[model samples]
Structure formats: C-alpha cells, structure tokens
Target: MRYTSEDVGLLIKTTQYRHHRGLDASLAATGISLVQWSALREIERNPGASMHRLAELSFNSDQAFGTLTARLLRVGLIERFQGPGRVTHHRLTPRGTELLREGRKRVMKVLVLSFASLDEKERDMLGTLLAKLLT
Candidate 1:
C-alpha cells in the first residue's frame, strides 16, 4: 500500500521518538538529558560557540537553547564567558569533557545497536542518501 501524508508524519514522529529514547537511555546514568547531551556535544565540537549559535546549530529556539545551557552550567559541565559582540560564549569544563567522554561512549553503544541491522554497504548508502537530503 502507498503511504499517505499521515503515514509520513507518523513515521517522522516515530523515528524522532526512537532517536530521543535511544539517546535518553544512553544518557541515563550520565546525569544529562538528551537535549543537554546534544547541547554539550555541539559546544564541544565548536569551541567558543555562543548560545545563539548553539541554538541555530541544534535547530532549537533561543529559549530552549538557554534552558539546555543553564542545565549544563548548573552541572558545571559548561562555562559562560565574555566574547566578541559582548556575546556570552560557552566552553566545556574538564568535568564536562569527562562527562562528554562517558556520554559519547554510551551513545556509541546505542548507535551500534540501532544500526546493527544495516550492513556496511547499506549503511554507506543510507549515509550518502541522508547527506544528499540534508544538503
């Protein structure tokens, strides 16, 4: 049967839910929410990144981004300092780095399980197709 718009919407929702769930499971013992984990990861990858930039990078709103950053700050996983344009910049602390290291290990385990069904060729094809769609 051909998929309808409803089918597509449901598929998207389901996929997103599963994605979050996997990340959540991975972060369970790491003391960070999925959003926080994502925020930290983004900041780590882009050193001296601002909250506005992080929001844009994560496709989250400014408010939502602030919430994530606040959580990380409370946990001492991130620090906010002054930067160009007087913007507040975020950087991971040593503890934050350690947490990220632990969190990534867990995330990788979850990812391996999630993609276990896909063989190497299929995985490559999926990655290529996803890149095309993203661009």
Candidate 2:
C-alpha cells in the first residue's frame, strides 16, 4: 500500500501521542505532568532565567507560563522573584531540585526503554533526521 504525506503526518502525531502518554504514565507517580517537568528542567539548566525566556524555551505563551509557574510555586518546587526591568526570574527551590533529580532518573528510564530497540547508529540517524525536520 502507498502512503501519502497526510499518512506520514498522522503517524508522527500518533507516535508523539504515544510517547507523551508513556511519559505521563512514568511521571504520574511523581505528581508532576510532563509539561511541568519540562519547565522545571529548563529552570534547573538556566537558573535565574526570566519568565519570558522560560516561556519561549517551553513553547508556552506568557499566560500559560504564568499559570504553570503559579502551580510550581504552590507546590513549593520553584520560586520567582522580581528582577531588573520588572522581569520575573525563576529558580528551582531545593525541593524542586530534588524532584528534578528523581524525575530525570525516571525520564531516563522511560527513554531508555523506548529506544531500546534502536541501536546506536539507528538512534544517531533518527536524531539527525529529526534535527533536519526541525530546521
């Protein structure tokens, strides 16, 4: 059977959905969604990053980032402080750091399991192709 471009797109979307579902399942025990984990990971990597920058990195709108950060704050996982030019700087709290460490391990386990069937060369090729697609 021949596949059209739409078929390829649908396959990609379905793969993404399945991957995210797996991630969600892995993270459910941690009480944080994948999006929240992504935000926390970004903050950990770029401490004192501005809310705007974090939003951009996370591909979230300002309003969405605001809500996400508020939830993080409520959970005592992160702290935000006003910085120069009224920008809000974000940093992971101690609790956040600890959670991130655990979460990273969990995520790595899931990733390893997901990619277990792909050998190193295939993984490299897939990464290259994905990068090309992004560009």
Candidate 3:
C-alpha cells in the first residue's frame, strides 16, 4: 500500500472525528453534547462576544448558532446581554461554568487515550507540526 498526502489528510480528518466521538461519549455523563460544551467554552473564553463571533469561534453557522444559543439560554446554562448597537452577547452561567470544568477533565482523559499510541516526544512533535500546519 502506498501513502500519499491525500491519504494523510483523510487520516487526519478521520482521527479528528473519532476524537470528537470519544469526547462526546465521555461528556455524556455531564449531560451536554460536544457541540453544546464547545459553545459554552467559547462563550466562557470570550465573554461578552456577539453570537456571530461565538458561532465563528465555535465553528458553526450564524443561524445554527442562533438556535444553539436559544437552547443554552432556555436551559440557564448561558445568559445573553445586549451589547453595543443591540448586538447580543453571551456569558456562561454558574451551571455552565461548572459543566465546563467537569467537561474539561473528561475531555483531557479522552485526549490522552486518543494519543496513547504516541510517546511524549512524538506527541510533542505532532502537536508542533499540527500547529505549524494550522498557522
């Protein structure tokens, strides 16, 4: 079997999907989907950011994020405020904060297992290479 850059790209995408699945399953005990937790994380990291900004940072479309925000708001996991020019901004509620903290622990465990095949040095190299590629 021959390996090419296209194969490498496909493998990268596949690995990411599997990693997301692992994280999602691990986080199920916390009662939040991966997407929801991701949204909460972005809101926590960028407090007072507009929904559009949050959606962009969370990698969702504006309309999809609008629906997500509505769900979050309804559940009291996040609160929205009117920013400048009537733009809606988001922040995590106490519940959201706790969930985020718990979710991070679960995610870390999944991430460690996901890369269990790699030694520390290989993991470091992979991280560096991926960062370089991303940048």
Candidate 4:
C-alpha cells in the first residue's frame, strides 16, 4: 500500500496523542495537567510575564488562562504582582520551581524512553523535519 500525505498527517497526530497521554500519566503524581505545566515553564522562563502575554503564549483564551493561573496561585505554585500598565505579572514561587524541577525529571525520563529507538542522526533528522514543519 502507498502512503500519502494524509497518512503521514494522521500518523503525526496519533504520535502526538500518545505522547500527550504518556506525559499526562507521568505528571499524574504532581497533580498538574500538561497545560498547567506549560504555563509554569513559560512563567519560569519569562520571569515577569503578564497574564495577557502568557495567555497568548499558551494559546489559551484570557478567561481560560485566568482560571489556570488562579489554580496555580491556589496551589502555592505561583504568585502575581502588579506590573506597570496595571497588568498582573506572574512569577514562579519556590514551590513552583521545585515542582518544575521534579516534573522535568519525570518528563525527561519519558522523553528518553520514547526516543530510545532513534539513534542520534535519526533524532537530528526528525528534529529538523519537525522544525521545518513548524516554520
């Protein structure tokens, strides 16, 4: 049977779904969803990102991101402060940083196992192809 572009697309989507499920399972002990982890990582990297900016970065609506932030705040994982323009700036708390560190350890294990079948060159080629697709 000949494979078409649609076949490749479906495979890519299925791979993504599987990866997401694996990551969700890995993160279950931490009590955070993939979306929450992504927001935390973004805030950790950005230091003082605004809610609007983070919402944009996370591809979430303002209200949805707001709810996510509220959950983070309630869990003692992050703090929000007043910024210049009256926008709230988010920063990871010490607890948040620890959670991220531990979460990354778990995620790295899953990633390493997931890519174990790929040698270095194959990994590089796959990475390049994925980057090209993104661009």
lDDT agreement with native, every candidate: 0.85, 0.88, 0.92, 0.87
Candidate 3 lowest-lDDT run of ten: 44-53
Listed per model in order, the count of residue pairs whose N, CA or C atoms clash below 3 Å is 0, 0, 0, 0
Between candidates 2 and 4, the one scoring higher on TM-score is 4
TM-score of each: 0.87, 0.89, 0.93, 0.90
Model 1 scores a C-alpha lDDT of 0.85
lDDT of 3 by residue, 1-135 (tens): 897999989999999999889999999999999999999999989877777888999999999999998999999999878888877788889999999999999999999888999999999999999999989
Question: Can you write out model 1's per-residue Cα lDDT over 1-135, one digit (the tens) per residue?
Answer: 898989967976886788789889779898887777788889989887767888988779999999888878887999988888777788999998998899899888888887899999999997897688679
Candidate of highest lDDT:
3
**lDDT comparison, 2 vs 4, better candidate:** 2
> Using lDDT as the measure, what is the rank order of every candidate, best first?
3, 2, 4, 1
Q: Which stretches of candidate 1 lie over 4 Å from their true place?
A: 1-12
Q: Candidate 4 at 65: error in angstroms?
A: 1.2
